[model samples]
Target: MSSFDETQDFVVVGSGGGSMCAALVMRSAGKSVLILEKTDLIGGTTARSGGVMWIPNNPFMKAAGVPDSLEQASTYLDHVVGDHNDTPGASRARRRAYLIQGPRMLDFLIGKGLKFSRIAQWPDYYDEAPGSSVPGRTVVADLFDVNRLGDAKSLLRPNFLNLPAPLEDVMKLPHVKKSWAAKKALARMGVRALVAKVTGKKYVTAGAALQGQMFLAARTAGVDLRVNSAVSQLIVEDDAVTGVVTEKDGKPWRIGARLGVLVNAGGFALNQQMRDQYIPGSSTKHTSVIESDTGEMILEMTRAGAALAQMDATIGSPLSLPPGGEEWPIKPGAQNVAAAPHAILVDQSGVRYLNEGGSYTEFCQRMVERDKEVPALPSYVVFDSDAMASTMIAGTLPGARKPDPWYEQGYLKKADTIDALAGLLAIDPAVLRKTVDRFNGFVAANKDDDFKRGARAYDRWLGDPFHKPSETLGTIGKAPFYAIPVIPGDVGTMGGVVTDEQARVLREDGSPIARLYATGVSTASVMGRTSPGSGVNIGPSFVWGFVAANHALTVAG
Candidate 1:
C-alpha cells in the first residue's frame, strides 16, 4: 500500500470549490500539483451549495454593460462589514484583502475556461444597506457538461439531498429573475435536462457545474488528484511548513512541497466535538457541511502551530421538522418556510431576539446568545398555516424522490390558538401568546415596528414579492397556528488556519507556511462580518484558488 509518492510542487487538501479552483489555477501555470480529498467525492461543500458568486465590479458585469466600480464595491463592503477586527487584526485584513481582490480573481477565472451567466436581477444581500450594486454582480457558472471530467466523476459527488429542485428552475421563478435572459436560460436548462436524460445522460448539479469545471480545467492541464489521501500532520521545519505527512490507501505517504500545502479541508461544522467546543448551543444543528468536514486537517495544522481565528463564530438559518423526524433536527437541512410569515424567532421565553431577515451567521450568533440567556437551543419559529401554504421549504419540493435526507423529519405542529402552539414548544404560554398578538398587529398594519425587517433592501430581496403591503411583513393571525422548534443550523463553519492574501497558509507569528495555502471555508471567510451578498461564500473561493495556484507556480515549491 506504500505509494511512496515523489514531492509535488503544491498539495491541496479538500475538494470544495476553493481547493478545486486553486488546484486548477496552479496546474494552468504548469506547476506540479496534488489535490487530496478525504471523501471519495471530489466536490466538498461546493457540490451542495448555491454555486453563484458575488464578484463586485467584475469584467463580466462590464461586458454585459452593467455599471459598477471598485470604489462602489469598497463602499458597499465598508457599509456592510465595517472594520470589525475583533479577532485580532486577522479578521479585518482577510476581509479587506478579499474585497480588494474579489473582482480581479473573478476576471482571472473568466480568462480560464469558467463562464459566468449573470444573475442580473439578483440584488446584493444588503442592496439598501449602503453602496450596494444593482443587477449583475452575482454570477453563476454556465451549466457544465460533467462528462468532460471522465475519471473525475468517480471522485466527485453531486448534491442530491439538500436542494430538491435544480438551481436553474428555482431562479426562474418570477420573484427571482428580473430579466428575459435568465428566464430563457431556465427554459434552456429544462429542455436540455429532458433531452439529455432521455438519451441516458448524467445530470450536473449547480455545485457540480462550478467545481467540475474547475476540476476539468485542472485535469486538462495534467493536475494530480490523490484520493483516499489523509494528511496526518504538517511537516514543520524551523517554524515553517516544509511538507505534509499523509496516509494514502492505508500506507504512510509523505509529499514534500517546495512551495506549501493548502489546508482547504473546510471547517468543523460537521464535527460534533468541534461544534460543541466552538458553537456550544448549536453543536447538534449544523446540517449543510460535508461529512468530511471534521476539521481534522485543521487540527493537524493547529498542532503544527497555525493560529485559528473567529473559531467561535458559525453561520446558519433557523429550521425544524417533527419529533421523531430524521430530517428536521438540523437547521441547514430543514427548510422551514415559516420565516416568510410574520412569525418571529423567539427564545424559550417567547420573546423576539433578532432581526428575522438578518444573514445566517448573525442569526446563529443571536440564537446562541438567546439560548445561553434563557436555557437551551430550543428556539421556535412561530407562524400559522397560511404562511406554511405559500412558503417554499428547502427540501420539501413537489416531485423530488424519497430517502430525501431532509424530508418530513421534524414537528410540523398546528393548533387553533397561539397559546396551544406555545404549549407544544414548552415556552411560557402567556408570553408566547402575547408575542404572537403583537406580531399580528404589525402584520395588519403591514410594518415591522420592532426590527423593520422588510424595510431593508436585502430583506426585500428574499421577501414575498406578491405581498404588496409589506414584502416581509405578514401575520400568524390566520386560524390554525404553527410552531416549529428551530435549532441553530449552519451551512458550515467559515474559519481555519491563518493564510496570507495570496492564499498561502501562515504560522501563528505571521510567517508563511511555505508552499502551504488554504481557501474557501478553510480560511477565515473573505466576507468579513455579515454575509454581504449572494455567492459571497463561493466567489472568494474561486478567486483565492487562482491566487494560490499562480503564487505556487511562481514560488518553485
Candidate 2:
C-alpha cells in the first residue's frame, strides 16, 4: 500500500465554481478539507465565464416576485431535454436532485456570507413551452472586490470581461447609443469605477466575482486551498476513491482523503484528439473555455472504473470570429446573428434557415447539422444599412467604424446592390434576392411564419427591445447589404464521468463507486445535451458539489 504524505477529511480537485462549495461543506461539518488546483491560479473556468447559475426557484427570483417552482422547472426540462438514453447523467433522478437542491445550495452559499442576485427577465430559451419561467431563473454573484483577498487576489483567475459594474447594469450599456437610460447606466458604471479606484478597491464581475466570494469564504473557514498542486491520479482502494497523487515540487505527493475525493475539473473541449474522437469536425480554436480543460481527471476517473456518457455532447454556441478576434478570449460572439431586428443568417446557397434568436447551443448545433447538407460552417450574418444604423453586430460597431482589416480579409463582405452582394458572396443573385424579399415580407406582416423568429420571449430579448410591433422582426431589403461569417463555437464541453443523484461516480454496471464524487464539466451534465437556460452548465456544477460534500460527510461519519 502507498504511504500517505498528508490527509484531510475531504479533498476537492479543481478550483471550479463547485470546488469551494464542497470544501465549505466539509468545513461547516467541522472537518478539515483541502482543495488542490492544477494551475497556478485559483478558480477554474468558472472565473473566466459569466458566473451565472441557472438554479430554478432560487431565493433571488422569489424575492423579485419571479415565479419559479421545482415542478415547473421539471416540466420545462421535459420539453427542452426529455429523458434520453445517451445522456445518462441527466437521468430523472439526477434532474430531480438538481432542481430540488439548487435552491438549497444557494441558501447554503448565502449563509456562508456570499451574496447573489438574478438577471431578472433573462427568460428561458423556450418560453413557448409549458411551465417555462418567462422571467428566467439565473442567479449571478454580486460584484466582489478582489482587493478584499489581499495577496490572494493575485492567485485568483481573471474574468474574461473587466467591467467594474454589476452584470445587470452591464447588460444595459450595449444600448447606450440609442437609449438615455442606457447612457445613464454607462455613466453610473464610470462613477463606480472611479469610486473603486479612489477607495483602493479592485472589483471583478461575472464569474470572477462568484469565484472570488467562494474563495474568500473558504479561506475564512480555514479550509486548506493550494494552487499548482496538480492531481495526476485518483488513488482508489478496493473500488473506492480514497485519495489523489498530485505533483508537488516536481514530485508525486500522495494526499489521502479520509472521506472522499471530489473532482470538479473541467472537460475536454480543448483536447483536439478527444474532439476528433467524440465530436468530429469540431475544432479547439473555436472554444471559449480555458486551455487547461484537457480531460486528464476524466481519464484518471475512468481508469478507476467510472463510466462515461454524453461524450458527443457539448454546450454549443454560435459565434462569428472576426478577422482579428483570435487575439482575445471572447471572440466575435454573434450567437444571435440573425437575432437583431434587421439581420438574418444565410447559408452558402443564400437560403435562410432556423430561427436564430432561440438557444445559442441549439443555433450552433443546427449549424453543425446543416453543414452536412449545405456549406454553413462559415454561414453569413446578413443585414442592411438600416441594421448598421440601428445596432452593433457580434458586439462590433457597424459601417465605417469597423476596421479596414474586416473588409480586406473578406471577413466582412459588402455590396451596394443585392446583385452585387450576391456577386461578392458568390451566391446566385436570384437566390439572395428571393431570400431577402421573403424575410422582408415576414417583417411587413409582423409575423415570421417560416421559422417564427420572434415567437419566444427569450428570442425577443435578443432583438432591439425598442423596436415596435416586434423586437426581432425587421426588413432586410435595404442595400448596401452587409455580411459576416459565423461559425459554431462553445464555452466548454458538458460531458465526462457519470455520477448518480447524490453526485457519486458510477461504474458502467450501474453501481456507485463508494466515496468518489464529481461535478462541474468534469461530470456528464445534469441537464444533458440541451441547454435549458443561460446557466444550465454552471447551476448543476455548484449544486452537485454541495451535495457531494454533504453525502461524503455522512459516509465519513
Candidate 3:
C-alpha cells in the first residue's frame, strides 16, 4: 500500500470465473476491488467453457427434489479422488472445505442476484462410485442476453456455440434421429432460436452465460474491472506480496493491494514450452483453452515463493486433428462420439485397451498412460458403417455433408472391410479383426468384460440413448469400417502453484505465502488429477476464490 501509483483493497490478476467471484466478495465487504485481465477479453477460458459448476448439495438439487447431501458427496469424492500424498492441493482439509462451503458459495452468489440452476440429469462421471449423484449436482447459469452488457459485450470472450442451446436440449438433440424425445428437443431449440431472432436479442449460453451473469453482477456491484492489464511481476517485500507491476502508457505502473493480490490467471496449456516442461507429450495446438491461457502468473507465483504441484496431470480431452485443424483454437473432441454405439478406440497395433464409454478425463488419461507401454499417441477410433448412419463425428452429424477434403485428405479413413481399414492405419488386420470381433461378442452378451463400457449410468448417458437393449452396447459390424486418428488434448493443465484451505498460496516448507492467494487453474486443483464430474475445475475455482476473499476480509478486519 505504501509508495504505489494506484491501489485497491484487493487486486486480482486474471479475469477467469474465480476472479469475479473474489471481486464481488471484496465489494460486498465495502472494500475497493480491482480485476486486471491480461487479455483483451474480459473472461478467460471459463467464458468459453461449458461453465457448469459441480457443487454438491446445492439448492438447485434441493429444488428439483434430487436427494444429495454433503456427507454423500464427500464419500463420493473420497472414493474417486482418494487422499494422495502427491496431490497436496487436495488434502483432507481442503476437500472438506470445498464440500462444506460450495453450497454456501452458491447461496451467497444467489443472494447477490446471480441466477443459477442445476442440470437435473447430468450424472457424475464416476456414477458407479459409492455415494455418487446419479442426478448430478451440476449448476449452470441461465442463458443470458448479451445486449444486457451494453457496450461491454464487445469485450466479452466468444463461446464456441454461436447459438447456444440449453444443456438439457443439447443432450437430447444428439439422439434426434433415434429418439422421439430428441425430435421434440430439436423443435424446442428451433423455437428458442426463432424467438430470439424476432426479439433482436443476442443470447449466450454455457460458460458464456455463466460468466456474463457474473460480469454483469460484478459491474453492478461497482467493482473496478480492467481489460488488457497484465501484471508482469509480483512486487514482494520481506517475502510478502505487496503489489504488482503492470503497464500504463507503455511504462511500469505499480498497483498495490492492501488486503492481498490474488493470482487467478490461468494454466500453462497454451504455452508449448511450459507444457513440454511440465506435461510432456502435450501439444499447445491441441489444448481447448483460449489462446490467452499461457500460464504467466504461475511463473510469477513461483518467483514470489509459491510452491507448485501436480504439474504432470491434465484434464485429458481426446481430440482429433484434421488437415488444417491447427487453425481452430478449440478442436473437435472425439471422446463423446468415440464412446457412442458401434465405436471403439484401439491402439496402433489394433488392440482395444480400455472402456470406450466412460469419463472423458479417464479416457484421455488411459490414452496417455497407455502411450508409455505402446505407441498410442495418435490412437485409432474404429467404428462400423452403421455408426456413420447415426453418429456425430468431429462436429458433423448424421446425413450432414462434411467437407470433401476430410475424406480426400485421409482424415476420414474408410474401406469396405475391417482388414482394408486396418491397412489404412498401418495396423495389423488380424489384430483389429480380433479386437472388433471381441467387442461384438460383448455387445451380444450385453456385457463389456474388458472395460465395462455401458456398466454405469454415466456411461449410458453419454451414449446413443435410442439404441435398443443397451444404449452403449451396439455391434461394430455391417461392412465398410471406418477409423479416425485421435490424440490426447486438454481443457486445462491440472497443476499450478499450490494453495491451502484459505486459498492462500503455500511455500515448499508448507507455509502460506503472506498476502498471496490463488484459485482456478492457476492453483493446483482440489480434485487432484481426477475430474470427478463435469465442472470440477470451475467449481473448485469458485469455492476457493470465495474462500480467499472472505479470508482476506477477515484479515483486513
Model 2, position 520: C-alpha lDDT score: 94
- TM-score order of candidates, top first: 2, 3, 1
lDDT of 1 by residue, 1-557 (tens): 22336788778877777776777666666678888877778877887677778888777688889888867777787777776654432455565666677777776677786766776577776767666875748877766667677756766677542322346566545333344654666676668778877775565657777777777777777878767777787777776677778786678777777767777787787788887787665554446666787888888877876777777655565555344343543333332253475566778788876677746667666777776678537677777666665555444432212233333453555678888877777777899878878887887887778877776665665666666677677877776776666766677776676677777766777887666677777766666546777777778777787778777777764
lDDT of 3 by residue, 119-222 (tens): 87888989999989988989998889988999999988988777647666676776776788878888877888899889988889888998899899999999
TM-score for all models, in order of appearance:
0.88, 0.98, 0.98
- Give candidates' CA RMSD values in order: 4.2, 1.2, 1.4
Q: Give the alpha-carbon lDDT of every model.
A: 0.68, 0.88, 0.88
Give a tens-digit lDDT track for model 2, residues 282-372.
9888888886899899998999999999998888878787775765576668855569877889999999988989988899889988989
Candidate 1 — which residues are off by over 4 angstroms? 1-5, 88-93, 134-136, 161-168, 172-190, 198-200, 323-336, 397-410, 427-430
Sort all candidates by lDDT, best to worst: 3, 2, 1
- Model 3 alpha-carbon drift over 4 Å, by segment: none
Ten-residue region with minimum lDDT total, candidate 1: 398-407
Model 3, residue 196: what's the lDDT? Answer: 85
Residue 203 in candidate 1, Cα distance off native in Å? 3.2
